[model samples]
Target: MTFRLTFCSLIALAAASPALAEPVFNRIASFATLDNMAGDEDRTRATSAEIMTATPDGKRLIYSDSPLGAIGLIDIADPRAPKPLGNIAMDGEPTTTVVLGDTAFVGVNTSESYAKPSGVLRSVDLAGGQVVANCDLGGQPDSVALSPKGDMIAVAIENERDEEVNDGAIPQLPAGFVLRLPVKDGQVDCAGKQVIELTGLAGIAPDDPEPEYVDFNAQGDLVVTMQENNHIVVIGADGAVASHFSAGSVDLDGIDTDKDGKLDFTGSLKAVPREPDTVAWLDNDHFATANEGDWQGGSRGFTIWNRDGSVVHESGPAFEHALVRIGHYPEGRSGKKGAEPEAVKYAEFDGARLLFVGSERGSAIGVYDVADPSAPVLRQILPSGIGPEGLVAIPGRNLFASANETDLGEDGGARAHVMIYERAEGTPAYPTIASQDLLGWGALSGLTLDPADSSVLFAVSDSAYKNQPAIYRIQAGSPATITDKIVISKDGKPAETIDLEGIAADGKGGFWLASEGNPEKEIPHQILHVDGKGAVQQQVALPEDLTAGSTRFGLEGIAMAGDGMLWMAVQREWKDDPKGQTKLLSFDPATGEWSGVRYPLESGEGWVGLSELAIHDERLYLIERDNLIGPAAKLKQVTSVALQGLKPAPLGGALPLVEKRVERDLIPDLQQWNGYVQDKVEGMAIAPDGTVWTVTDNDGVDDASGETFLWSFTLGTQTAAK
Candidate 1:
């Protein structure tokens, strides 16, 4: 199998091969951590679902909630719809959890400060939600695992260093170690504890070993990853170190190594350390690590290693590059840790041995068929919530779950969530659109259909890539493929400071783009005309009278009307307009004259505004949405204004208001994917055959899940309700 296959090629392979047409994972439900809070509790407080584990029957999932200092439970009796079972408060911050029979062993941190670290292992009864036992661990705990035969439990005591002190350098004293205890008849024997010292094992931090994650293979051998030390240690069932080796390093090529507000994959990294985070076994002989770098290094991918620490295979930049093709690359984190592979899990289902690699920054999971551990094949990339920290697979029930630990609800963003996916007989439903030929793309703000071919479309990036504004030519299909990219240039260089939000194709091999401006930033609100080669030919700024009333929420969409006029949609109301009405401005190139009319907006909890515009079949279509995400999202829909009787008034005067009829409520369409409802429905275009295409803005994967959805639908000719 080829290693450099793009995401589209993988999908095509799965579709073409009968043997490969097996059950694929598709997200079926998402449970928000906020739902576990009591009705009287402050829902505004932060919460998280980090490390997770499932019951033997796979009917329940338990995850550690560090912020809430509790363990959250979810009942998955019906895999399609997960229900929150509330949370059980712990003595301190919960770090990890593992289920053995009806008991859950959780590691909790109760440290007062970095100098005085303390932790405990608590055993809870799953049915009654009560702590049954507690064992003092003498240090901060990070990861916990159960033995294969359920006869032993292991915990990684990571008395981690304080980054603020001496820049988080190691040898901070009170060296870390691993704890092993026996399990008797579904109960923890706290008194039968054994300590395995890890000092003098790593070259980087020999004394202060910070063990990040721990796992057990089928033979009860434990694998521990000391991330900051860049070392891996394996212990036998008798609690003796069997093998220890440095996680080593790799030289990365064809990667984006800077956070300069653009996606440039021409850079390279030399001798980057593979500071492994989560370690999981593929069998007794081989294991894998998510090389999530710490303070010094992170190789931006995963590594397959033998028990003796020899490299079986190194992903290098392939995993991160694969994410780049799917628009999940975290450009904002490029300078620090690109895509940050932080979690790994190995599971077998129906004779297929698979490995799941989770990207902490990119918020995606790369699935691979690792039947031949020496050469793993890239299978699919699954989208998760922001900051996927934990993954659990229950082969018994053919279900998998990811614990996303980032919660921005207090700031009106998506809350932490546990997304559940079920393996069934169908194709993967994610990655509705992807780029080919390694073309990195995201933040799709506007789209335009080609006049010559309805199956071809064009899209533009917003200010997310202000330094490298580009136009992407797309092949509009079931899973849209970006075939080409043209950088918008001025004076033989990439344009700068342009916040392109809308695009319209010119009949004569050119495009009309609407740039949404920020007055405070001095990015002018203007319309630009670019030729087929993406060279700026002309720029038209708003009139002084109109600019006087403008704010940052300026022009969002532009469309060429049938009457040879360019119509642009202003996102929100300006100072000169009445509340709940935004402008629909028209420009006649023949006369260079500007006119305008107001479009009424729907009443909603958050501010509603226009994001895109398209003119088709004598009707002007617009995407109207509120600035809310997840379950709070409402009013994401396509609305239309009939152009037959529409009239415009002159600028700096009383503008006529046009009535809008709702064409399609897009909230249902977004919900069909079974993920959180995205806030930015920023791009839409209509094919000549009346098909309506839409795309979402991922905000350049900054404080976002970076999941782009490109879907299409057709509407009937009947009149819609206003």
Candidate 2:
């Protein structure tokens, strides 16, 4: 089930990294959810890791996989390289899982209808991977928690309402409550079950107090989040309600409120309800909630609260702003809950008390040092796989784990994944290039090193921000930052029909941009010359002979050759070219003539094509990568075609094949990020001082973690300090 391919498992490195921060958590390994169902089953089906818990020694992990109707397990004996222990079949959908000693207690939902919901508590032996006991519950369960003493289990019996009926308005019958079961000798004592009533407490939907999530503190006190009702409740050890209150609202400012193709965070949401999704006991007297709103509102942040329902600290828009600064903001979800913080976990790491908040939509987790609960400090933000639904920390081993619940298997996209991270003395190994919103940006597609200053670079965003296509000026510093941005303009307005994928600097204080064409989308395959002021000076259309043979996978990168002629790299084979070959087009600015040569491409599993082109030392350096992601990504390299004897033939004539030499296998550099290999290695450049810089596009935060990795290598040249 764990296929280890030497070629794909190779880890490439760019620079030697010591600790960037004294105590930081860095990714160690990633396991795909489909690996658990790799036998005779249809592994292509959707799978998920909704909730998870690790063993006492951190040697194994048990998680709920609802889509597969099973409890999945992973052997973390070697934490850095986790191996799948396979999934144990469950009679019903497992909602949440909790580990106690040698057994895993799971809440299983067997509901056939909303009105008559039913569930069961199943205990599975971790050693034998078999269900040892099952206890029937009168209602459905959503979350499961274990007592601090490991003597009792708490289950949030959420008889949830159907979203399809009347927009999922609450008070729709069959109210829910909390179920506490005693544990005797590592086995759940079903005979000692207690159903604690939790209805007629919420002001909005008092008749249906649907308990969504439950977490227990050391004093046998439990905090429950009634998500739909926007309420919170605390239950004491005697199975009696202690105190309850509204989760409350927040007035958020400087937030994006629309999906209008912009990263503008100037809008505001006033009096928004903090519909809490996941709750964690910050301490015996305090707790935290991720405000993932339902129908009413979502504060787009997190909040810390006292047991008596007093707000201690409110994140408001600060967390989402951190995501925006890292280019992980979900612009498409602006109209909804930005980032949608859904999971919260509290633990002590080393000598620091920490809180981990997971963003379901942004695919990011914000780590906070909660030593001072009233004023928590944002320590780090870890990139998670799509839809991080669950988080578990293994402090004993200094390891952290995330259960990412998104499975795009039906679309042949990335399956659900579980990522592991270790606390160590080293840099984060991600975001070599990041921003503090010096200028809001995303989807960086092309890079152009400053012809004069080796430390200055310029990059461009693609059609993702079609309404305002802009080129960013980057300061190649330790954490290469975006210092400024220039919006490309047409007349007096932002260019409309543009998909700027490549950029090249002209000698006359201007730039030549190659916009990949999508004719059906009204965008033409053309090149534009822009003055230093960012105004369009001239536009050149492809010759009819070449235009007729082009596809949407048009010109990807452009560079200036030795003769002052502009050269562009076609991403893929066109209608006229043979298989596994694309064109290196040349356009003479002085003569207004066009010629082309064939660039041979190596065959791979997925389509392999050029993404970027840079002219360094008279050779055409190009970034070539496959369209696949993760382990399926077999090719991501920088290859150069010597220009010494290269000649371009006229359009419609037989083109010459240019031989290439592999300059760098970029997979190593990409692997240093420690997550999955990004599919786009789109931008590459060589500084005047010989530093090799490259960037991967974030796809404008669409179905992505929106992590744009920018790093430099001094492979063949001396590393220079900027």
Candidate 3:
């Protein structure tokens, strides 16, 4: 550990005893090089999700591809030398992954058609140093959990089919079911396995639509979470419904499970299904979920529950009248209006429920009380300066993690870090100041706490800006510190940090990161790997297809799916040409290769800009920055796609689909009164229970919008427009 001891600390420690090992937060190299501008194809843009991860043995590093497809990979055997291996294709846009031995299960989805294999659940093989196989699934698989033996993979699947219209409008179906795929030997063939229908179990009408998330209990029983119904359905191995519990049911103060003299369940767990989100398993009988209501509701942060269907802890406030009372009214004498409350999700830490919750408007984390499963309560808040978009946590060490972006003066900036909390009682819940800042030390665009040890932290910075961002490490110790940054340079001079945004740890010895440069500048985009000592070991430039463009091909969000492969999401470059949609790409960590296929969103699909990118279990969770719409940000999940085999249909379409009403009413208000438009959504993280924890970059609300507010989205709930 390279220690950057504070001048005073160095003297005291040295004078008293041998100086403790400290990690120095030094600069390495910057990424620069414009690509595809000189009439050359292969240009790329930037997104906020550029993070990396290492293999279990620390021999290779994996990174995501924010290109047309949703995945990418890298090899990092040498600290100062990184290389790109190969890439692959997926059914839907790829998000996150979970690695076992040689297999990686990826989450994907398509619009309104998740019942079939629209959600591509790919099983990648990394044993041969290359991706050998990829598979697709019927439902939009959100998260993945492998049984102890790595067989019978439980994937939370959701089919967002359209609900029926009263007149001759487009038809929509209720939410679909979650599937448990059995990975036998080295292959994944869903047709040969048993598929359980979850619609009926959750009381979901065949026409009321909702998404499904699944996780295994301590005994390996499947716990399926439905955002619409606000319930968890336990599926036994026999494929029969074991039990069903309400996410909205809370153990009231009058009814105590422990027979204590206090209120048992304060606020119930409500279903705030906004978009593709997450849920987490707290323990064998306990679980935590994000309570951001559906398109018609509002919630902030997560809630804990016990197996007997009781709320143990409650954070934030409860939803009344099926809606989170967003007090937007102003007092008669005051000039300011009320601010909106937020929600939480994407939690981790087994012993303690450490969740990363952010507000749709405010850039902060809502630290809720989860000590009890029947009565969780909101306790403190961690304001991450700008938007707290993503979250990661490591238990047994009191370490909480998050990622966000801020302005470095005129130089727009981003940061990712691991904050060590003082778990002692009365410790002032959320520290006004961060335990340690990984700013210049590293990029806070993406970060992850080492599952192996919370003391070890990894972070990645987006280099798409002029300063080529890099990766850095931080170790927990007295006067806890950061290490020197590590990034590869071209032609001896470090490139301007384009956007080294995403990061992840392999839980072994090494770390990985992804970088995206300005395509208009014609610079090459690639993924890099680094050793614990902050050395650039390997690097891989993106593929031609991913970079072929003179427009800005923004490659950002990234993560490691299972199988040592990498997944990425990129914003389509907008230039002189007409507006079109972007795509998700994949890469191979073993050979620094690229997959030719890309998963394109629906035509006319538009995003204000993509920010925080995350993956958990087997699903992908990405945050679309404030898109001039209702609420301040947009959270989306890419679950299923229409893929026939290795081939797909044509590409080249309009921006992401935008409803006419959304454009006029929902989108514009995000900028309310803050002279400048709000770029609300920024960072994002996934909890073990499948909840999506995201932060906002409200840049301060406009006068018309009243006070500034942080926001969080529960999967099925609808939120108020900014």
Candidate 2 residues lying further than 4 Å off, grouped into runs, are 1-21, 715-722
Instruction: List the candidate 1 regions with Cα displacement exceeding 4 Å.
Output: 1-4, 13-20, 717-722
Model 2, position 154, has a per-residue lDDT of 92
Best-performing candidate as measured by TM-score: 1
Candidate 3, residue 86: Cα displacement in angstroms equals 8.8
lDDT of 1 by residue, 185-205 (tens): 988888898999999999987
Which candidate has the highest lDDT of all? 1
Give residue 24's lDDT in candidate 1 (0 to 100): 84
- Local error of candidate 3 at residue 663 (angstroms): 46
- Evaluate model 2: give its lDDT: 0.85
* lDDT of candidate 2 over 1-722, digit per residue (tens): 01111111111111235633457777888888888876898876888987988998899988899988998999999987789889998899999988887888889999999988999998888889899989998889999999989999999999999888888887878999999999888888888989888888999999898899999999999999998889999999888899999998999888889888867788988899999999999889999999999878889989999999999999888888777766788888999898899999999987889999999988888888898899887767788888899999999899999999987767546678898989887656654666635256889999997787778888989988888788888888656767677899989888778899999888677899999997567678989999887789899998888988778999899999767989999999998999999999999988999998999998998799999998988889999888888778889988998888788999988999999988788887777766777889899878766678899998887677677889888646432211
What lDDT would each prediction earn against the true structure? 0.90, 0.85, 0.43
Better of 1 and 3 by TM-score: 1
User: Which lDDT tens digits does candidate 3 get at residues 266-311?
Assistant: 2243333322134566667776665544433334435566656565
Backbone collisions counted per model: 1, 4, 230
Model 1 has an lDDT value of 0.90
